[model samples]
Target: MSSLDGTVAAPLSPPRPSSRLPRASDQDGSYPRPQMLRGAWADLDGTWSFRNTGDDPAWRTGFPDARDIVVPFPPESPASGIDEPGFHPVVWYARTITRAELDAAGYGGAAPRLLLHFGAVDHRARVWVDGQFIGEHEGGHTPFTLDVTEALGTDPDTAHTLVVRAEDDPHDVTQPRGKQDWHEHPHAIWYRRTTGIWQTVWLEAVPTASIAGLRWTNVDHATMRLTVRLSGERPAGARVRITARWHEGDEDLATVEAVVPVHAHEVEVVVPVARQQNGQAEDELVWSPETPRLVDAVVSLLPAEGPEPLDAVSSYFGVRTVGVDGGAFLLNGRAYDVRSVLNQGYWPESHLAAPSRQALRREVELIKELGFTAARNHQKIEDPRFLYWADRLGLLVWGEAPGAYAFSPLAVQRLVREWMDAVERDASHPSIVTWVPANESWGVQHVATDPAQQAYARSLADVTRALDPTRPVISNDGWEHTNSDIVTVHDYEGDGARLATTYADDAARTALLGGRGPADRRILVGGAVDEGQPVMLTEFGGVDFQPGAKREDGWGYTSAVDDDDWVARITALYDGVRASAFLAGSCWTQLTDTVQETNGLLNADRTPKVPIERIRAAVTGR
Candidate 1:
């Protein structure tokens, strides 16, 4: 198939090796990774000796004599390499992927869409297939794909060697590294940095003429509409048939079918009430964070000549809505307040990668148990595991980016691109309600005023609109916030009333074009705090370490170095902060202690740092 961008699909110009089958060196204690992956399916994880450059550096030639670290996990992380010092910043990764699957899939299709899907490669990495120069990809946060359809040797049944070279310096502030500190090990709000293939790699097979993508309009039950987009060569009357199977549990439910003529890149297929369209019963389940019901769908293409499954992809969708009338936010046409905690998805064992699905679900379960409906993932693009559970477990979410504290046009471009991929890849979930670009102006200058930053933020807004416009996007989360659907504000120790002072200033100073969303955690500051504004107090209440105990410092208004006093003081302030109407909602500092900053509601081992009862009182106001 031709490239989606109109460029000729590049083939294996370089010769590939008829090499031996590739397999990971070590698999002991490695994550039970998923069987299947999207894009060019490849798994570049397993076991490799990890050593920082500061150690004896003699492993470049033959295998170094050292402890084994798991692949895909950064050397800085305990999960990767030996639990000792993390891998040297510049490290080499070795792994192999089965090419037989690619050869088998290409049996009947035009050709196998063998792509190397890297969830994320920190700093930068170069890729090789069977020692063939596949390509190189930069950017550590987003996912990227490479078409290596022709790179595999002629043999249809052999594993091809896949090599990746990763390098990252902790001090490089120009990248979109959320909270990694270079000089010292992660301390005081800073966590360890993960470099190289933090995400998954896989190969996916598709027909020459395949449905590139599809859009579900997630309306109400009776009026579910979907748009089908076919890529590649299409005849004038090329017929595309879509079969949608909606299910609740084991019980087989309803199935809807539609056929449309394929245009260049799109074809709008309206699915009206079954009765309204063809006098058939139209019954479909709705999805929300609460119920989080999912309806499954499989799109099949049948040519006008007869019946043939040109392309088929099994997908799921959720039906939900968000809006606001007066002051309250609404979900499913009802009032919903955004109560969230800053959730940074990090684990003691797997910095970003969750050991198992349960690890991911536990985070969501703990958040709900804390008596909150939502969580704002602090500053990083989270793994899909979190979303998978958020959709099933009923937790509203405010998705944030791995912050770009250092500003750059190139960095901004990569940020927006990766974010777009994240948005489109995860848009079908029901829990995600908000989108963000800039968080606290870490990498921005006069973001609210600077033309470039403004344009970048606006461009992100535009991209979000083009991709999924239903949700809202904050151009810049905090500083110089403008051009957003919601009035998102960020404040630290300010009281509710003092927090509301900004809105008062906005109301008093600038003309109100129209009311936007209650700005982030600071939706409405209120009376109280002669000392400060009646802050919504969105971010408060994180004392991971015991008070009076010396641990790593964290980045927040109040750091709880020790759990005893700091925890009590931090939790108490949150309790006091929530007592004002000036604040519409509040999300605590964070869900878990990411790396060294241990002031999470939960501990590094998924343990509750603070007793659940202590935190629930503040959330439920008991």
Candidate 2:
């Protein structure tokens, strides 16, 4: 195999603080797929060959340039060791896979096939194995995989080259790049860009005919349903074995099992849960932020003739339903008001990537401690690891699709495809109660007047419902909503009394009748207000507080005089949202400071700027 030799560039910059965070255990270590896991896999995440297409055209020659850089971290991130903030339209990555490693990982046999998984790559990605083209994928925030067993030599001791090329267009507003700075340097709201691979990359071995994907749906508190999709060469009379166990805080409560024959490459199985003597569903461990209960699951593919199971995967799920009843947001048949904070998914040093899995958990824990039950992951499809913790810890999430600024055919197609992928990948997690496709007219600005834009918004909501009917879909979050389960608005009124007056019951009615509402000209796009739908002040109260000195050119909705002033303003604004009887919920400006937006409750390093208790009291009114 060709080696990386002369293409290495000089060290660009020193390591940032985020790079110091402990790396996850080796591949096959911390379990990237904690929910649905196979026993053996290889971690291909340490280092890889890197080259910018402009620097060299080695990718055309079927060999990557001899440059070394860390895998998963974007070249623009300080954690990547090559902190070049300049834009590179096309970049390439190459890594070697040894057959010995494959053999040890149970991928040696002729029947077992190797699946290469990429957690994410910005914009578009084209991949190859041993000079043989494999596949290409668009949309950067979702995972995609390729089967590469055919490319590996028949010998189990040879090495194969895997090459990848990613194309990210900073100026292309048609692409969905959430909060990634379009300019050369950091600007008002956008931070540094994430050009290439920004998450984990690994490999797994699966039987030729095995389970491809799973979708979990809770029919009710007592009945759970799962749909298993199969791929590969299926043997006749293949069946699936499913086992579930209820758990509350590590304590096992009950167990249930089911088996169903697979037909037409798909099968749906229902597992009925028993109840205790007190008439409570034993497996009802209904999932919620305050009481996060999960059910451990093991699913196996049972071949007709083999005594041993063909393939078994370990997974977990929560039983819960999120819906809307009248003006109240219902969670599992009860009225629930959302106390949410916006998380832009950015770090001072890591930019779009989290420092570690612990960092992800800490953010959720901090959100819960601050008296918030839900977090709106703004403009970005967050890491799966974050969703894993959200499931285990019981936090509600608004899984939003990153926005594309310009509206075009390319933009619509890309957003739809990527959003569907994002929904499919994270639909099983009970934490994501809602799917938000557009934010504040980022992509569909003409929804109010343009028929096509209005139809597009409605289509997105319809498609989302068709994909996962269990959760609500916010077609266009924060204004001009065409067809949505919830009408969300963003109002950054700094004064509590003014905010209260603006959102008053009479004010809401008057604005609706006048064909416009507060928080920009945001009104029901195609019709009058529907009293049955819930209204949410999804964004408000951005009181800027830079501890040392005031930033003259930084961005925040409103400026605060001091710490005390900031706290008072925040409390006042929240009080307005809390007292508005017409609204079902509200979300604060943000959870942490990102780039030049210094209006977060927490500092850049995730340390609380305002006392946690004080903020908690303001949000929960305790």
Pairs of residues at least 3 apart in sequence or in different chains that clash in candidate 2: 27-43, 35-315
What are the per-residue Cα lDDT tens digits for candidate 2 across 483-578? 788888888877899878777785664565346666557568766356568888898887788888767666689887777888888888988887
What is every candidate's alpha-carbon RMSD to the true fold?
Answer: 9.3, 9.9
At residue 361, give the lDDT of candidate 1.
Answer: 72
Q: Model 1: per-residue lDDT, tens digit, 283-374? A: 13555655666655445555546554555554555657664444445576565657788888777776766665566778888888887788
User: Candidate 2: misplaced stretches above 4 Å?
Assistant: 1-29, 53-57, 60-65, 249-251, 276-284, 305-307, 506-514
Give per-candidate clash totals: 52, 2
**lDDT by candidate, in order shown:** 0.57, 0.78
TM-score quality measure for candidate 2: 0.92
Candidate 2 Cα deviation (angstroms), residue 199: 1.1
lDDT score, residue 221, model 1? 37
